[model samples]
Target: MSRALFAYPKQAQFGRVLPKNKIYEHTSPSPALKALFVQQIDQIVWQYKLAPETINLPAKPAVPEIQIFDITLKTAELDHDVLRCIDKAIPFPIIFQLSHDNRIQTIATYKRPSEADNNKWVIDGYFADDWQPIETPRQPLPVALDLQGLYEQLLRRLLPLPPREQEALKNHVERLAQWHGKHNEYQKLQAKLNKEKQFNRKVEINAQLRRLKTELEQLS
Candidate 1:
C-alpha cells in the first residue's frame, strides 16, 4: 500500500516565522491566500523534486510556521539513500523540518520546556513528541494539464472525479495541504494512486503543480 504523498504547494519555507494568534483572527483574510500558500509548497517540491512521505509533512496547517531543528543523529548505515534530506532537522515547536539528504546532520540546540507551555497546551508549544514522524501529504495534479502540461492543469475536473476516487483524493489533499515536503512523499503517494504501486504520476503531477506555483511565489 505504499503510495505517493505530495501535499498541496509545499509547506512554508523550512525556517520561516509563522504569524501569531492575533494574525489568523484578522477580519478579512487575503483572497487566494490559500492558493498562494499551496503554490509555495509546490515550489519547494519542484525545487527539491521530492517524491513525498510522512516524516516531512510540515504543511500540517495546524503546525506553527516558525520552529528550530536539531541535527545530531545519523541515518542508519542501512539507509537506502545516503544523500537523502539536506540534513537531519525540523523547526522546533510547531514548525516542521525537512532534509534533502538523508546524510543530514542533527543540531543539538534544543529549547527548554516551560511551565506555561505545559499548563496551557491549548496554545502552540514545543514538545518532545513533535519530533515524531508524520504521514506525508498526498496532493494530486488537476486534470486539465494532467492530460497535457503544467500550462493547463485544471483543478476543477478533480472536483467531480469518478465516484469515491474523487472523494478520497479531495479529503487527502485537504489534510496534506497543511505541511511542506514529505519525509518520504514517494512511498506514501505510490500506494494511493490508480491502485498501482508506483510513483511517476506524482512526478508528472508535481511538474504541472510547480508551473502554477511560480506565479504565487512572485506574490509571496
Candidate 2:
C-alpha cells in the first residue's frame, strides 16, 4: 500500500508566523473558542503554500490553493472547533500539522465552497492519523492532475476508510461519515450489552450490535 503521510516539496515552503489574534479578528470567536486557542495552542505558522506556482498543479474552482498550517500545541489533543475557526477565517482549503512533545499528527476536514453560496465554504467532519515521531519518514506528495485531486489525496490520507474502486471523493467521504455513525452505534450497543445484568437484555443488545457491525463493514 502507498504511504499516506507526505513530505512537502521545498519550493512550496512559506514559513511565516500566523498570529492567533488575526484569526480571531476575522472569525470573531466566542469566549469559549478563545479559551481553547489560549489553553491548547502554543503557536501557528503558515508552513507551506501549495499553489500552481509552487507545486505546478493547476487550480480548480473548489481548490484554488491549499494552505499548510503547522501548529505547535500546549497539549497533545486539540478541539476540532479550533481548526474549523481557522478554516472559516481563510478562504482556501487547509491541511494542519500539529506538533506536541516531539511528535506530529496530520488532520483536516473535507472543505469546499458551498453549492448555494460561492462566498462561503462547507466543512465536513474532521479526520486525523495517529501521532508519529517528528523524525518519521514521509512519502512524497501524490501525483495528480490538479490541485483538487491533490487535496483529495491529502484528505484521503487522514481518513480511516479507504475509497472503493473508482469512488468519487464526495461519495467516499460520505461513506466514511456513515461508517463513523455506525461504528458509534456499535460501540454503544456493545457497552450496553456488557453492563446489562439481565440475560434477556444482553441478548437483545448483542443482536443489535451484530446488525450494526454488518452495516459498519458495508460502509467501510
Candidate 3:
C-alpha cells in the first residue's frame, strides 16, 4: 500500500469541534454504543470538508462532498461500530483519521448510496492503514476531475491491492471484500486442519486447503 495519509489543503479546513452529544442527537445510538463512544473516544473534530466551494470539484450524485473527521481516541483500538454509528448519522461519505498516543491511522469504509433506496447508504467494509507518527510527511491529495473521483482515489489508497486498469471504484471495493472473505475462510480451514488427528481427514483437509490457496492466489 502506498502512503495513504494526506495533507488537506488549508483552504478546505473546517476546524470545528464536533461534540459527542451532537452525534448522539443525530444517530440515537444504542446504550452500548453510547458507552463505547464515551469510553473509547476523547474528541471528534470536523477537520476538513472537500466540496465544490473548498476543492473546486463538481459533486457527483453519490458523493456531493467528502468529510474528513479527526477522532482522538482514549484507547489504541476503536470498535468498528463506533465508526458505523457516525456514518449512519452523517449522510455524506467520510474519511476518518484516528489519533492515539501521538500516532495517526487513516480508515474509511466503502460507502455509497443503496441501489434499493437512494436515501440510504450501504457501507461495504472498513479499510485502514497502519498507524504512523503524527509528524509523518503526508502526500498532497490526489488530483481528480470530480468529488466522486477524488473519493475513489482516497479509498483505493487504503486497500491492500491496486485497482485493475479502467476498474470502477465499486468493482475494486467488491474485489477486496471477496478477498477478505476468502482469506478468513482460509484461516478457519487451516485451524480445522491443524486440529484434525485422523490421517484420512488430514488428507481431505489438506486438499481443501490447497484448493482455497489457489483461489486466494487468483484473487491476489
Candidate 4:
C-alpha cells in the first residue's frame, strides 16, 4: 500500500490518519470564505504532523510548509484518498508529490471543478521527467490555464511600465525569476563553502561563485 502525506496549517490537529469524511460543518458562501477555510485546513494538517505530540519533524525544512510523505502508493489510489478526505464543495487545491524507487517521479495538483467548467478530476499540472501519455487515462490532464494577461496586468500595476512595453515586461519578469534562482544557488554554495574544510572543494566552489556572479550581472 502507498502512503499519503498531507500538510495543514499549524493550528489544527489530526489523529493518526486523516478522516475520510467531511471535517468542517459550516458551508462557505463565497470563494473568499472557501479559501479561508482551506487555509485553516492546510494549517491544521501542517501542525498535526510537526507538533511535538505528533511526528515532530525537524524545525527547519529544506523548504518550509512542504511536508513529504514517506508512504508509497499508486498515483490513482493516493488521489482517491485525498479526494475522500477533502470536501467536494469547498474547492480547495492540494498538491501531491508521488515517489517510487527512492525518487519523486511526479508532482500533481488536485483541485475542485471550476465554476466555468464541467470537467471533474482535472489535473492542473503533472510534471515528470519520464512522462508518457496514459493510453487509458483515469483523469483529465488538461492544458495548464493561461494567466499571462492577468500576470502582465499585475506586473504593470506594480512597476507602472510605459505603454506598448509588453515584451519588455515579459523579459524583465523572466530575468527576475532567473536571477532569484541563481541567487538561491549562490547562497547555498556560500554556506557549503563555509562548512567545507577541503582546499580543493573550496576552490571548486569559488569557481562556481564567480560564474554565478557573472550571470547575476547579466541579469541586472
Better of 1 and 2 by TM-score: 2
lDDT of 3: 0.92
Q: Candidates' TM-scores?
A: 0.17, 0.95, 0.97, 0.32
**Model 3 Cα lDDT, one tens digit per residue, 1-220:** 2378998999999989999998899889999999999999999999999999998999999999999999999999999999999999889999999999999999999899999999999986799999999999999899999999999999988999888889898888888888888899999989998889999999998998899899888877
Candidate 3, pairs of clashing residues: none
> What is the descending TM-score order?
3, 2, 4, 1
Q: Model 2 scores what on Cα lDDT?
A: 0.91
Pairs of residues clashing in candidate 2? none
lDDT of 3 at 155: 92
Model 4 lDDT tens row, 1-220? 1112223334434323332123434332355544433433332221122222333332221112222222233332233323233434223333333333344322323232455674342333221223223231232212222222322232233222233434564455456567778999999999999999999999999999999999977776
Question: Which lDDT values do the candidates have, in the order given?
Answer: 0.28, 0.91, 0.92, 0.40
lDDT of 1 by residue, 22-112 (tens): 2224323344543333333221221221112422332222222223222222222212111112111222222123333332211111122
TM-score for predicted model 3 compared with the true structure? 0.97
lDDT of 4 at 128: 22
In candidate 2, how many Å is residue 22 off? 0.8
Ranking by lDDT: 3, 2, 4, 1
Off by over 4 Å in 1: 1-11, 14-73, 77-92, 95-220
